[model samples]
Target: MTARIGVVTFPGSLDDRDTQRAIRVAGAEPVALWHKDKDLKQVDAVVLCGGFSYGDYLRAGAIARFSPVMDTLIDQAKAGLPVLGICNGFQILTEAHLLPGGMLGNDHLHFICRDQKLRVENAGTAWTSDYSAGQEIHIPLKNMDGRYVADPRTLDELEAEGRVAFRYLDVNPNGSLNDIAGITNAAGNVVGLMPHPEHAVEPLIGTGRTDGLPFFTSILKKLVNA
Candidate 1:
């Protein structure tokens, strides 16, 4: 059966359509989910698309974390449902305590937008299985509070357990601790990253690079084999 992937559209979300398109391009059915809805439509996985959710009030993603959908998402995620959070969605994941750490202001104290290079550190996660360890890919990055910070022990734990799924390459765009660009939960079912993979899935579009397509494909492969 073809995988059905849900893309959640919180208020201020900018990439929900693109994410759904990417899922469809990957040979999966794209289901649109709303922030206020409790039902998931039985999607095999979920993607929290990026944007300035809730206008970034009280910190990015702070308000959206309490959305009705998140209540269900949190429970399902703990039960082994796969989730991928990108950009502002990453912030929400952290705020919801689904992922670790907090997103702080960029070290430069400015909104940044650029094509970023990242190294795949963990290829075994539900969202990254299509990548190979140490492989490098370029994706777009944009955000003001994009820096990732965590206590020393937590950082150590993430590194030691191979939970650091992606690391910035060449240059750190946001001064994230340990140059971490993304991380996965211990179960490998929840993954969050600052870079915008949904924006890079089509080669004919921005940057003409399709490096981000694997994220969708990886989940499709997992669901098919399951």
Candidate 2:
């Protein structure tokens, strides 16, 4: 069975097409979802790709949290629909309260872009099953407000519950608490991360590594086997 995944495109989304290509490369159909629409196109899963949605002027992903598409996306996500949010998409997830924490400007006060190393801390999430716990991988990372922050109580809860799905390696690029690069919802169906996995899916691309392909493949496998 072929899984159809929806990729939401906000007005200022920069990586929608690339994410769509990655979905196709994973042997799934990519469904383009517009910001003004609430219908999900009956997709089995959804991805909110990296971008400066609605122009990150007032804060990344703040405006996108209210998009018509997100109305349904939020509801469906709560019902166990698999969702993966990357970069600004991660910011949106926090705003929507689908995931914990908010993003702040990098501690260095500058946008950083490079191939980043990450350690998979929880490989059981819907988007991470193809990887093993403690596995290390490289993916492209680029962001301005990328530092993840949360209340101390929330951080303790997440750590205790194994919700921290990935952590920065080599360097904590954004000074996020606990070196968090990604996290998952308690249900393991929703995930948010800062790195651009879609960019590293093909070996001929960025770092000549396909470390990110497993994300798309993992979701496809989950949906097909379910």
Candidate 3:
């Protein structure tokens, strides 16, 4: 059966359509999910696309963390449902406590937009299985509150357990602790990242690089095997 991937669109979301397209490009069915709706439409997996949800009110994704959809998402994720969060979506995951750490303002205090370099730190997660550990890829990074912060113990645990799925390479765009660009939950089913993979899935667009396609394909493979 073809995998059905849901893309959630919260208020002020700007990349839901792009995420859907990337899912389709990866040969999966794209399902649109609303932030206020509890129904998942039977999607095999979910992606929280990047955007300034709630206009970044009350700090980045703070307000959106309590959305009705997240109520279900949090439960499902704990039950082994595969989920990926990008940019502001990453912020929401942290706020909901589905993932560790928090996203703070960039150290430079600027909304940065650039093609970023990252190293795949973990290859066993549901969303990163297709990538080899240490593989370098480029994806677009754009946001203001993009710096990832966590306590020293949490950072150590993440690193020791191989939950750090991606690490910034070359230049650290937002001064994220330990150069973390993305991380996976202990179960490895949930992943969140600062860069926008949906924006990098097509070779004819943006940076003309398709390095981000592996993320969608990785989940599709996981669903098929499951």
Candidate 4:
């Protein structure tokens, strides 16, 4: 059966449509899921696309964490449902406590937008199974509050547990502690990242690079072979 992936749209979502298109291009069915809706529509997976949800009010993703849909998502994620959060979506995951750590303002105190180089540190997660460990890829990353920070103990645990999925390859753009770019939960079902993979899936658009296609494709392959 073809995999059905849900792309959520919050009040101020900017990449929902782009994410939906990328899902289709990745050979999966794109199911549009509203932030208020509590149903997953039986999607095989879920993608929380980037954008300034709730206008970044009350500290980015702080307000949207209590949405009705999140109530179900949190429970489902703990039960092994695969969920991918990109950019602001990453903020939401952290806010919901699905992913650990916090994203503060960029170290430079300015909004940043550019193609970023990332090293795939852990490919064991449901969303990154297609990538090889230590593989490098370029994807677009744009956000004002993208610096990832965690207490010393949590940081040590993440590194020791192999939970750090992606790390900034070159100059760490946001001064994230340890150059962390993305991480997965202990169960490997939940993942959150700062870059925009949906924006890099199509070779004809943006930077003309399709390095991000593996994220969607990896999930599809897993669901199909399961």
Candidate 5:
């Protein structure tokens, strides 16, 4: 059976369509999941795409974290369901405590959008298994609150457990400690990042650099071969 990947749409989601397109391009069925829905529709995996959910009012992802779907997502993720959170989705993951740390405003105090260089520090995670360890890729990143902050103990634990999935390669745009860009949960099923991978999956796009395509492809491959 073809793998079904769910792309969630919150009230203010901006990249739900793009994420669904990327999943379809990767040979998976893209299922549109509503924020209020309790059923996952049996999607093999889920992608929480980027956007200013809930108008980003209280904070980037504060309100969106309480969405009803996230309640199910949090539970399923603990049971090893594959979950990928990108950009504002990453913010939601942190806010929901699915992932450690929190996102703060950009250290530069401005919204940043650029093709960012990131090293795949941990290729064993569910969302990044297609990449090789230490491999570098350039992907589009855009956000106002992209800086990842964690306590010293949390940082040390992540580093020690090899849970740091990606790191800034050349320059840290938001001054994320240790140049962290992405991380995974202990089971490797939940992954979160501040970059916009769905935007970088198409070749016809700028630079024709489809560096982020691997993320979608990896999940499909994992599901198909399971």
Candidate 6:
């Protein structure tokens, strides 16, 4: 059966449509989910694409975490549902406590946009199995608040548990601790990343690279085999 993946769209969401397109390209069905809706529509997986949800007025994802959609998403995610958060979505995951740590403004205090290279650190997560550990891939990243920070203990725990899913390669654009670009939960069912893989999925679009296609493909494979 084809996997049905849901893309949540909050107010001001800029990448929801692109995320849907990428999901379609991956040979899966893309289901549009609304932030105000409490239902998940039985999607096999969920992807929170980038954008300034809630206008980023209240410390990025702070306000959106309290949305009705997140109420269900948080509970379902803890129950082993696969979820991927990109950029602003990553911020929401952290704010929702589905993922650890939190995002801060760019260390430079400026919004950044770039084609970023990252190394896959953990390929066992539901969202990253299509990548190999240590494999380098480029994905477009753009955000005002992108720095990832955590306490020393949590940082050590993440490193020891192999939960640091992706690390920035070449240059650290956001001054994130240890150059972390993405991370997965201990269960590996939830992941949060600062890059925009949906933007890199189509070869004819921005960056013109299909490196991000694997993220969608990997989830499809996991769901189909489940």
Which model scores highest in lDDT?
2
Which residue pairs does candidate 3 place in steric collision?
none
Candidate lDDT values, in order: 0.95, 0.96, 0.93, 0.93, 0.92, 0.94
Candidate 4 C-alpha lDDT tens digits along 8-39: 99999999999999889989999999999999
Number of backbone-clashing residue pairs for each candidate, in the order shown: 0, 0, 0, 0, 0, 0
Instruction: Kindly provide the TM-score of model 3 when superposed on the true structure, using C-alpha atoms.
Output: 0.98
| Alpha-carbon RMSD to native, per candidate | 0.7, 0.6, 0.7, 0.7, 0.8, 0.7
Between candidates 2 and 3, which one is better according to TM-score? 2
Instruction: Give the per-residue lDDT of model 5 (tens digit) for 1-226.
Output: 7999999999999999999998888888999999999889988899998999998899888998888898898899889999999998999999999999999999999999989999999999878989999999999989999999999999999999999999998899998998999999999999999988888888899447889989998998898889
TM-score of each: 0.99, 0.99, 0.98, 0.98, 0.98, 0.99
In model 3, how large is the Cα lDDT of residue 48?
93
Q: Which residues of candidate 5, in runs, are more than 4 Å off?
A: none
Q: Write the per-residue lDDT of candidate 3 for residues 141-208, one digit (tens) a residue.
A: 99999899999999999989989999999999998999999999999999999998899888899779
Pairs in steric clash, model 2: none
lDDT, model 2: 0.96
- List runs of model 3 lying over 4 Å from the truth: none
Candidate 3, residue 141: the lDDT equals 93
What residue pairs are clashing in model 6?
none
lDDT of 2 by residue, 1-226 (tens): 6999999999899999999999999999999999999999999999999989988978889999999999999999999999999999999999999998899999999999999999999999999999999999999999999999999999999999999999999999999999999999999999999999999888888889999999999999999999
